[model samples]
Target: MNAHHPPGQTAPQDRPARLTVGVVGAGRVGPVLAASLALAGHRPVAVSAVSDASLRRAAEILPGVPVVPPAEVLARAELVLLTVPDDVLPGLVAGLAETGAVRPGRILVHTSGRHGAAVLDPATRAGALPLALHPAMTFTGTSVDVQRLAGCSFGVTAPEELRLAAEALVIEMGGEPEWIDESARPLYHAALAIGANHLVTLVAQAMELLGTAGVAHPARMLGPLLGAALDNALRSGDAALTGPVARGDAGTVAAHVAQLRAHAPQAVAGYLAMARTTADRALASGLLKPGLAEDLLGVLSDTANAASATDPADASEGPEATDDGADGGDL
Candidate 1:
């Protein structure tokens, strides 16, 4: 339970330093943030939750907090957390400002990585101090999210004058603040999407392929291998490139393409794409000899053109695809 005080009195632990916090959108991110702030001596005065899940989450994470309307939330909170979706953010800020819900001197912070403080221009113009503090970690919308904040990086963007305040709030939530230029917010978000979001898709596809290959406990089978591969990639980068493509083994590459087309036809396209990309990187890094790459490139081209590389026996090789092979190295 939060330390309660009489009307207008701040939490005694921090006295005037304690803020009356309000959550505008009680989604997975909002309630978890509110709970974290409460731990940092802030008072969660009110929260706005419309859906059953949001209501339940708020109740679970922020017990005893009042569920109020947006305007009422703003009215009660000195520090307002706007944790709505990126698309809904602009309208929410505009509406709050237009409805006179934006109180001057109040802190208006949002958690959208795609947007900086500019999305909260309406609220800013209304005298609210705008801040964009987006946590870099994924959220479960549960209490787990609060713990995840520890040492997590927060992409923080704010007006120059309010930079200190923005970073301070992020620190209070147990996050390390990484200052981001307003203009770079979109690109920063895109980089994270490419790394984190696409990674999830890639892992799901790998699991599906393993299951199709008759592998039981695919996750258990993959866990250690994937862990080591990820660690090696992080530590060694392109130098860590292995497998047939890196060694310029056209025969092994052809074998993989044919096997995928025959067993997991849907995986053929992705296989070709990644193999081609990996080959390109390997060649660029001198891991693949240009003279030895012709056969591999030719096989890829033939499979792509045919769109039906069904025969593993038909997969051809170059002189380099000798007994030495890619040292039977498969990733």
Candidate 2:
């Protein structure tokens, strides 16, 4: 029971009382999160930073906090923030538990979108409170990330008994708490990765293609166009889609595929894949008629087959194209 509130009463509305916080990983995320917690009135006591970049980030974000080993950080902090990579988290927690570093009643939180509170079972077994609090925004290991936390949502997973405490901590860090079921953690993380990480790859590919087209300032040319496209997509979903594929312009799409195959062979596969998917989605969303979709699909199929026959090596690299027809379409 919290000392400040009676057993039957609800917890206070204001920020929770200050507690000594320690960070186990001073990577891009840890330092920024620790800085945010410090800004929320928590006392940052110790942090573990192995790399030179991590050390610099810690010095910049968590100025006075002592750099210590993970065990020492765990031993001294009332709340421990484990911000290591997802693959390393379970083993780290188990190793700390084996060494008796985690104490009873200490709050152990991990920042992995791929996992929920279940990944902290080792800490829980050591009698610590396990919580998963993954901030939805990307981190930069800079003060800018702290400000980004203001309107961000945190994917929180905890035992029913500790839900309020978990939410309180996220709220204090200037984030909204979104409860995520343990079973759905992987899918939830996959959605974020596809939306954010894949968007970066797509943008890079676009800029490279623009450079190939002799655009001196590709970003400046794409900025407003891409921004408006993103806004429309968000506001109207597939209904906002407007491109050669969406418009059922089979001839244009065939031309695009031929150009990509000849000059940007590596990008041909992605272009075909996205075009096929877009056609399917547009048809499903009533944005394109079934007859038009058939025409687009036929063009895509013939272009893919032509590309495959032109270079068997390219055919073996990406998704297999179904044999529909030869590449001699003007439709």
Candidate 3:
């Protein structure tokens, strides 16, 4: 670990004198990251929080850790992680820059998968090394998140001069860093949403429909099935796709639509839309005949639309809210 520390910084006898890291927004990612860095031998010197609950959580989660305001964290640490919600990042950075809270020689990083380092352009112009380091994992609020950091992939973006620092941070946390151009951020995040966020939605919908079908303990039953399906998908790619849509069984799909229409009227449209998309993918995979795919989609579409239009109350109620993949399978 000493050899792994970047040159010019002496390793601490008690803790790594690596860049003093300060975490902003002591929410899910902040405290977990602080703990992970601490476990990795780097000092997480200070953390910032705006709310009482956040401050309490920070203190409770990391006893003896100071929960200071944002400026204090920025002023005290060489590296500052702005882990605030995505919507507030630009404004927060801009506000920090305007107030001269962002210090020179400090590395400013955010954990938003949707935005690249460019979101911190204000801080960059103010002489900070702007960086984006998004860990590809959901963070459930706990010390367990520290352990989960290991072996995950991180999406990193930084200027050439600060690239090594960014890479070193990921490596220190036991993650492999994948460099992405700032301009490609949207598409990258979209892929994450489709794979991670929408997977949660799809799974929750499955569990709900399963419950409607008289399956006891929907979560327990769905867990292993979803796990196996995910494992297969990761190992075999599109070849792992299975079940009625993959098999191009229009009859099964039609029956499913009919059932949703009668029992779980609200889920009918979403089920049909997803089924159509799946059918399209199956068609691309050459698993489904063109005529059969069209016919299946047609049947689903008509039933879904008719059910949706007739029952206006049903349209507003979509699938149950899932974790948005922010907390992994548990969410």
Question: Per-residue lDDT of 198-257 in model 3, one digit per residue for the tens?
Answer: 888878888888888899989999888888989999998878888898887888888887
Candidate 1 clashing pairs? Answer: none
Q: Tell me the whole-model lDDT of each prediction, alpha carbons only.
A: 0.84, 0.84, 0.79
Look at candidate 2 and tell me the lDDT of residue 130.
96
Candidate 1 yields a Cα-based lDDT of: 0.84
For model 3 the TM-score comes to 0.88
Worst lDDT 10-window in candidate 3? 322-331
Residues 159-267, candidate 2: write the lDDT tens digits: 9999999999999899999999999988988888887877887899999999998999999988999999999989998999998999999999988987887778889
Clashing pairs in 2: none
**lDDT for residue 259 in candidate 1, whole number 0-100:** 84
Mind sharing the TM-score for model 1? 0.84
lDDT of 1 by residue, 1-331 (tens): 2357676665545655789999988876888888998888889999998877778888999999999999999999999999887777888999989999888999998989889999999999999999998888877777987998999999999999999998988898999999999999999988888777777778888999899889998899989988988899899999998888999999998988888878888778778888888888999999999987878889888988877544444446645522211010000
**CA shift of 150, model 3, Å:** 0.6
Reference-based TM-score of each model: 0.84, 0.88, 0.88
The superposed Cα distance between candidate 2 and the true structure at residue 48, in angstroms, equals 0.5
